[model samples]
Target: MWIKSARIVDPGQQLDFTGNIHIEKGKIKAVEKASSPMPGTMHEEVIDARGLWVFPGIIDMHAHLREPGYEYKEDVYTGSLAAAAGGVTTVVCMANTEPINDNPSVTKYILDKAEEAGLVRILPAGAVTKGQEGKVLSEMGLMKKAGIVAVSDDGKPVEDTSIMRRALEYAATFGLLLISHCEDRRLSEAGVMNEGALSSELGLPGIPSAAEEVMVARDTIISSYTSCPVHITHVSTQGSLEIIRNAKAKGIKVSCDVTPHHLLLDETRLYDYDTNAKMYPPLRTGADRKALLQGLASGVIDVIASDHAPHARDEKDLDFDVAPFGAIGLQTLLPAVLRLHFDYGLGLMQVLSLVTVNPARLLGIDGGTLKPGSRADITIVDPSTNWTLSEDMIMSKSKNSPFLGETFRGEVVYTICNGQIVYRKNGI
Candidate 1:
């Protein structure tokens, strides 16, 4: 297959030009400028992307493809379809499923299901603690052998300091990356939204920013003490960013990712008691949103992930006080990032890097480039297209998105993974 006459933008390679991406046998055989033309008999498939944009397929480091147990909300195939529609060709799924992915068998099961799905690269994350109980260490050595790119007890923090320290040290011995959810259960439990005037006015329980900051600080100290590289996930507060910044300044091996919802929305959106606005580490002040944007622009934040947690309609349509704390993000990630690029004055390359090269580097995956000999995982986007997001267009079984009914400026028209065109928008 040949993608011809497209504006190729690969931030990892510092490349931007009108070019052709030639795919052969599931690999990028060539990435050459338009100056080179193909003979009539050279290929049978040609995609004339005259005015379109082609980029390295995005890698989302924080996604929840609930399989092996909770297939009701989402399965491997459905989640991959949603991801492919969003231009993501690689996704690292959290180990927060019903039967937590602590042992190697669950990891193998996820991989096997993903293999059957055959839409994108699905990497599994192992639980940091056995059964995600935060009490005993998991079978890290055995799970590593089964191919977990990272380990984290997401949706639940390792609150036990001594246990977390030992987990860090043990993970480091196996050369694995440790990811933290950065929330103190005690401070965040039963909270419905941000802890401030908004929660008070709405008569909702509040989750203080300190809930996130306290764990952020603890993880930093543990990383320092253990000499292990730790990654903080979904950082939502200015105080947490400051702590991470200070840790980086001290030469501690630490990294972090921010979610699209945190970057784009604030607590004000919850004034109407929209359950979709409910999220763990709930949105904060306008000032916190500004700080998170600045962190991404200034390189304090390493990448952008969707944290694409999905819930059934019956689960999300309940009263705000009892509704689940998450909103689907797989389909809205690009436009949210584009707002940063086109409106906030961030370079397009920089915005694209947060989803592509940066996340790939964090996971040590072999993607995020259009260079010759790389995998043919690519996404074609139309920057000029204006469209409204709706439930019918969502490929995932769940329609729990905060961005539903909102208009956006960009659209992903096609997604190719492993040289296969897994998703393509209608009419082109």
Candidate 2:
């Protein structure tokens, strides 16, 4: 396949220009600035991206593809298809599936299902505890041998400090990253939303910012003691950001990520009790949001992940107090984020790095660069295109997005993964 006349965006080298990309046998053959179309080769497909911005396929480091038990919300096939539609070529699946991916057998089961689906690259994360019970540690050695990229208890934090310490120590031996969902269950019990003026006005149980900050502080100390690579997931508070920044300054092997929702929206949106506005580490104060943006700009935050947790209509249709804590993001991540950079004064290259090279480096993957020998995983986006996000237009099985009906400034025109055209907008 040949992609011609594209404004290629390479985050690895901080370069963007009009160029041509050639792909053959599932690898990028060449990337060069072109003056005109070259002579046609035999049996080659051509794509004319005259006015689009081509970028490395977006990678999501945190996603939940529910399969092997909970197909009602989403399966590997549909989840990956949603990711492909969002211009994401690679996704790391969390370990909160129905049967919990705790052991090697379950990890292999998810992989086989993903292979059969063949829509996107699925890297499954193993559970930190057996059945995610937070009592006993899971078989980390066996799971690593079976191709698990990392270990995490996403929906639930590992509450036992001793067990968490042991997991981190064991994981370090195998060179595996330990991703933690930093929340103190005891402090967060029965908490419905952010603990502040909004929660007080609504009379809802509050989950204080300290509930999240305390766990982050604990994890940083443990990581420093064990010398293990620790990544804090979905940081939502100014206190948490300060902790991570200090840890990095102290030379601890620590990294962190911020969600688009956390960066764009805040707890004040919950004034109306909209269920879509509810999420774990619930939306924080405006002050926290500003600090998160500053952290991203100053390089304290390493990557941006969707945390694409999907729930069915029956689950999300309940009262705000009873609704689940998540919203689908894979289909809206690119457009929503583009608004932040292109319209809100954030640099284009910096915004692209949050989803591209930054994530690839965090996961130790090799597809985020536009280098000649890299895999042909590329996305073409029209940054100036104006469109409205509609729930009906999303490819995910769930319709729990917070950006429905919102106008956005960009759209993905084409996505090529592994030398194949996985997604292309109609009439483009």
Candidate 3:
């Protein structure tokens, strides 16, 4: 496979150029100047990519591909197809399935199913506690051996400091990352939306910013003690950003991800009782949003993820207070993020880094690079293409998205995973 006349953006080394990428045996063989074609390459299937931008396929460090128990929402095969359509070649699925992915057997089941689906690379995150009960630790060693990439209690936070500390120390020995959903259950329990004037005016239960900030602070300090890598997923508070920034400055092995919704929308968008905007670490105030943007631009935030939590329409059609937290993000991540970058003056390289190299680094994978010898996971995007987002056009089994009906200025034209063309636009 040969991709010709493409503007290549290699975030690994901060390199960008118009080049031709050659792939053989599912690996990138070479990236050469567009003018220099191999003298005897007659067998290559050349793809003209003029006017399109190619980058390492996007990686979502946080996603929920409900399987084993919760196929009603999404399964490995359908979720992977949604990921491919969104230009994501790799996804790290959170351990929030029906029967939580806490044991080696369950982890293996998910991985094996994903392998059979074969649409995208699925890296499963094992649960930190057995069944995510937050009481006892799971078989971390066993799960790691079964090919789990990381451990997380995504839907709930591990509130017991002693147990969490032990998990961190144990995880460090095996070089496994501990990704936490930073929220103090005591402060956030039964809270429906962001705690602010909006929630007050709407007569809804509110989840204060401290619910997230307090946990982030605790985890960072604990991580410092254990000398292990701890990642905060979907950080949405101003105070949480400050804590993460200071932790990184203090040389603590801590990283955090910001969701596209957090970067592009605020709590005010919830005025219409749109349950899609209701998510854990709920959409925050304008000030928090501003701080999040600054965090992304200043490198305090490490990556951008969809936090693609897909729920059934019935699950999301409840009253705002009773609706489950989260919405589908796989299909809308790129367009929503690009709108903020191009229209708001964020550098293209910086934006791409949030989704590409930055996430690969978090997962300790060799993706997010166009370097020779690397796997040929690539996405070609037209930055100038304009279209409105509609739920009907998405490939996910669930149609729950917060950005539906919004017009955006970018589109993914082609997606190549392991040298196989997984998706391509009709007329591009």
Superior candidate under lDDT, 1 versus 2: 1
Task: Using lDDT, give the best candidate's number.
Answer: 1
Q: How would you encode candidate 2's per-residue C-alpha lDDT over 1-428 as one tens digit per residue?
A: 88888898888888788989888788988888877557659789888888888998888899988887888889999998898889998889999987899999999999999899887888899998999999998998899888888899999999999998998998888777888999998899999899888888999999999999999999999999988889999999999999999999999989999898998899888877888878998999999999998997788998888898888989988999899999888877877668778767878788888888988887777788788889899988887788898877888888888777888887888877887888888886
Rank all candidate structures by their lDDT, best first, as comma-separated numbers: 1, 3, 2
lDDT per residue (tens digit) for residues 1-428 in model 3 = 88888898887878888988888988999888877965437787888888888888888889999898889899999998898888899889999887899999989999999889887889999999998998999998999899888899999999899999998998888778899998888898899989888889999999999989999999999999988889999999899999999999999999999999999899998889999888888999999999999887788998889999888999999998898898889877777667767888887788888888888877788788888899899998998789888876888888888888888888998888888988887775
In candidate 3 the C-alpha lDDT for residue 205 amounts to 91
Per-prediction TM-score, please? 0.98, 0.97, 0.98
Clashes of each: 0, 0, 0
- Candidate 1 residue lDDT tens string, 98-121: 799999999999999999999999
TM-score of 1: 0.98
* Whole-model Cα lDDT of every candidate shown, in order: 0.90, 0.88, 0.88
The regions of model 1 sitting more than 4 angstroms off are 39-42
Query: Which portions of model 2 show Cα errors greater than 4 Å?
Result: 36-40
